[model samples]
Target: MADYYLAPDGSDSNAGSSSAPFASLQTLLSALEAGDTGYVRGGTYDESGFADGSDQHGTASAPIRLEAVDGADVVFDFGSGDTGGLRLWKCSHWEVRGFTVRNAPSYGVYVFGDSTDVTVENVTVEYSGGDPGTSGAGFHVRVSANTVLRDCVSRYNYDPSSGGGNADGFAVSQATDTVVEDCVAYGNSDDGFDLWESTGQRLSGCVAHSNGWDLDGNPAGDGNGFKLGGGDVPSGGHLVTRCVAYQNRRRGIHYNTAEVAMEVYNCTAWDNPTNFYFTAGEHVLRNNISSQGTVNIQDPVDDAWNSWTLDVGDPDFASTDPSSSKFLHLTTGSAAVDAGTDVGLDFDGDAPDLGAFETDGGQDVTSNVNPVLKAATPTGDGDLAFTAGTLHYYDGSRWVAPPVSYYDGSQYLTVSEGVQTDAGLVDGFERGDLTPYAGDLGSFNVSTDRAAEGSNALKTAGGRSAWADIRSTEKAIPHGSTFQARVYFTDAADSAILRFGVADQDNWLGAGYNSNESGIQLSESVDGSWTELGTAQMTPVTGEWMTFRVEWGVDDPDQIRIRCFDADGVELGTGTTTTSANQGNTGYGFEYTFQYGGTGPVYFDDLRIV
Candidate 1:
């Protein structure tokens, strides 16, 4: 029995049997005979408007079937451009179930190349592509290797790349033995399941939440769920079970470091703020639970506080956002209850839990230990005297800085007890007056310790500007090594430029500079007549204050060169340095502009790189 009739009032030849129904779904599956089964009599099979070499080329021992006419309800949409859905080109043993494929400007269902046994079950891919680039891809599996996507459901297939670039619910690139199990990709904005550089895959019992989309419509970049391995290192080994990634601003599972061998069982990532990061390669995580806001087990390239078996609090379930009508909102005993880990399978025996349900259990404690996680007990006898009460300063970002409207709005944001002031310069800003009182924004030194550039320095009249920018470390001048800078200018402005240098200034060693682009060989010009262009790149140094960037003025005549290259005219390397008016030809002034290139212990920072 063969019956095929698709709306818009029928009749292309009418002979697909059941009632002479034969209006070309490749001529009613080429008049089926091999494993005979053909029936497509729905109402809306527009494929947007059908014409662009209309094709539904299916073949594998004569296979072509699209059944659902006995109560009528099936659809393969094509409302715009990339050509009317159902273009499953390149031969394969196929089975495409109960249709509802909408808007395709790029790809609704496109599986190209020497295609294999492709099965797209109970399909429903909407909106395709919208915001960015063209509107394409709902079920787009390219360069196909071994495909399978079961019980699929992708809503609002947005491609916020307009010309049709960023749109993915199903975009598994460079595929291998692929398997996407029990699927349900919600509100897909950017990444719902954007698995790139593919390999043997298994994404089981899936639920990619929020799936953010609408940056152009502006929801601020919504829930980006499941973006595992970005830019290299995902060629094989797979398993990401029982998933439910909530809110998802950054992660639900984005670990692709080429470390390869992987496994993440019984998963549950709540609130999902920048979660899960690990690499020693061969990965395996049992009974997973990363709670509300930030779960980074390790990744800045290395040292993850000693890798895994982690529990950073609150996985107390019953309320980790779960409810599709199968037991949740559990407050009963709560702290994630019976906890989990069975590898044996228990419908609800209570103890194999860690995410996708399993009796809702929680708590493995993960062996405790977060006692500040060790490493920071070296006060070495303490006591550093600047003489009056107590005021010291040097907080690194690198080499003298203060230009973000100068801090009243607070640009750099980190302070764990660093930055105090006394010894001289006291006016409005710049490293000499010191501010911030911190740790961890970028650099830090006092030769190596007093916490904030010890030895003696405090200058804040606010001209060459350095609410703090410390950098140096080019040996200083070997006289046992230790430089110094202390000024308390009132500043009426006749050029207050104090700059210092050595390495990381374009990677400098000096023939006049290149330690990665230099702080301009050191400059020091204090005026309004407190008169003291200090050492101006002088000589003896191990001064080590360390904290840099915001060298005021902008270039040369007065100093301001942090990390170099801002390019308004271009030319950050070539001489013209000396000037207390050229004291001793290069002695310059103010303790040799904090000295470097002679001894060794000078890592200074707090403005002066023009």
Candidate 2:
């Protein structure tokens, strides 16, 4: 095992030592035998058309490695080069890491001719194959086997002469056993990850966005986020899990004429022309989610518990803003949360979430199994239990199926000191009285205009002073509990802030629809100063009722999660934040405050602790 060095300043005739390094990479690469390591020093190397070590071979126990120096910015600039920038032809057991390759007329890094056991990590490839009518890619692996690519990025590699059709971020053709993990491909001319006639490919935690477009914003290539297959051979057997594809020009995850079965689990596709275009393969899809795009799937595909197959609506994403980091993550109370069948994947809740990112915040799942449907009746006592998704009890003679209890707008609302009703412990403003509230009662009233459930709702006066709020009477809300309510804004043009949350004399923790920002906000106040925790973009439309759910201590004793739903029960946005406000303290109840001035009133109804 020996060490060699390459630098931009040294001469090629110099000894490949640390003091007198070789000038070009070819000198170091061609001289490295088995168990040799080459260090590329920081600086730009303008070498082109060098292929002396293209067919080098290394042993399994003593593989060769070429890596950038620690904390060095090593760059290979193939300026107007008419060949592949870095070619590893028929190389075996080679590892390359921490380097940048750009401005090549062909592929930035090409590993072909049966290269096996090659690993590439932390490498960035951009601006490859920009010449006229030339097809190129950032990373191309053809006829390669056992290749691993991790933490790599490929972007802005376009072939305009081919109408952006031939340039891809990462193209693996006729390859077997390829693992691409934690890679990002964006702003490319063609598909992000193109696998043609490839088998046994596993892509996990990869993100592909803004692909299939040229630098001039012209539509180019197929525009697929992940084109899993394309060739005459029906090669498949691919596994794509926890991957995100968004904002592509065409399809997000496509099965391009591949006949073999592929497994796509817990992937998310959003903002594409077509989310999942699985028309050819007999794919196995589970715990996947697609939003804001058309789903075009054919028969023979084994799919279940997906967002498209379920009768329920969208998965209630935490944030739809693609620019935000949490684009497709699930939120609290989402239909996608814990709604998936176990598919041999680890999850964070009762079951797997139907998306790329789990929302239970790392909660351990003890057991996740679909309920069995018992066709035979109970023969003895205590044999009756949950059978076929319903509770059946033996009444000493026969099995009696009881009504499944669901949320019917009644639970956990109680007051230990004040009046109570069958409706709830907190006032629903149904009695046309204000007995359950103690502060600022004159600024609110029961109106008959609109309500979420019943006919009447509480309406706040139009002109209340800034910071004036009404507090409900003390109710028994335990720490780490969650509350839900429905709120309607009568005037969209108003700039007033309709704030609703829980509060005590010293601490205030809540969320509200702030019209001034045209968004929803989660905030906390200790003493008298208020601090915003998180905010999401939302447009307040007139007469649009929204549901807000605030959960205290969801992940920890000081953590809070907030979710806001639109009129159609679709989640608009969500936020999470930690609070220094007191938990499990007395005199804590719901509080609705009018902050700032507006001309129209806001309505609140259907308050429940759920």
Candidate 2 residues lying further than 4 Å off, grouped into runs, are: 50-52, 131-134, 361-610
Model 2: lDDT equals 0.72
Against the reference, the lDDT scores of all candidates come to 0.44, 0.72
Per-residue lDDT for 460-536 in model 1, tens only? 21222122233221112211111223222121111122333322222111211212123334433332112222122
TM-score of each: 0.26, 0.59
lDDT of 2 by residue, 1-610 (tens): 8899999888889889999999987788898878899999987788776333577777899998999976466778786456647888889999898778877777788888989999998788877885563467888888989999987878778886788898999998899899998777877899999988887799988878778987545688889999998798867789998888988899999988877799999898988989999876679999889888988888888877899898546777877754233456677778888888787877776777887777675322211111122244574885754333445678789976543211111111212112223433234565444433545667777788877765778777656555445554333355566766777866664432323334443455667666656777777667667887877777765677788777777568887777888788888777777765656442333344445444557777877667
Residue 139, candidate 2: C-alpha displacement in angstroms: 0.7
Q: Which ten residues in a row are the worst by lDDT in model 1?
A: 404-413
Q: Give the range where candidate 2 is weakest over 10 consecutive residues by summed lDDT.
A: 405-414
